[model samples]
Target: MSSEKQNLKAGESHGQCQEKAEEWMQSTKDTANAAMDKTADATQSAKNAAPENKEQAAGFLQQTGEQVKGMAQGAVDTVKSTLGVGDKK
Candidate 1:
């Protein structure tokens, strides 16, 4: 092949490689952006669920407290009955 023709072909090959590199870079950037967006959405979802979790915990604690109170009252009544210190209902 002629030198000029060889050089032209080499230049075309370099251009094609450059184009491929740019395309790869653009694809990588898009993928990175999508990943970041998904992470942000997940973070926000967790943040949104936090209050609901807290409310549920509070409700559970309240229910547990009430149960404990009832048990204590029953124990007190039983003690009084055994000791004959108070009238049993």
Candidate 2:
């Protein structure tokens, strides 16, 4: 291929990569938001139920804790992935 054609192709490739990165970032943000919302709802439900049902309230609280832990783990994993350092495979 000619030098001009090669440069054009490289530019196109770079643009595509940028676009994909943007999409990935948006998706990550969306996922984080949804996780936070779920955590908030679970916490609220647990608090409201605590006055009415002990067992059910405990379950809700447990769910909320698990959600928080999962979110933390997700954040760690995302950071590792972005830095290209972490689990292999």
For model 2, give the 10-residue run with minimal summed lDDT. Answer: 49-58
- Which has the greatest lDDT? 1
In model 2, what is the error at residue 27, expressed in angstroms?
Answer: 0.5
Q: Which tens-of-lDDT digit does each residue in 1-89 have in candidate 2?
A: 69999999999999999999999999999999999999999999989977779877888999999999999999999999999999899
- Relative to the unseen true structure, what is the C-alpha lDDT of residue 35 in candidate 1, on a scale of 0 to 100? 100
Q: lDDT tens digits, residues 2-89, model 1?
A: 9999999999999999999999999999999999999999999999999999999999999999999999999998998889989746
lDDT of each: 0.97, 0.96
Clashes of 1: 0
Indicate the TM-score of model 1.
0.66
What lDDT score goes with residue 15 in model 1? 100
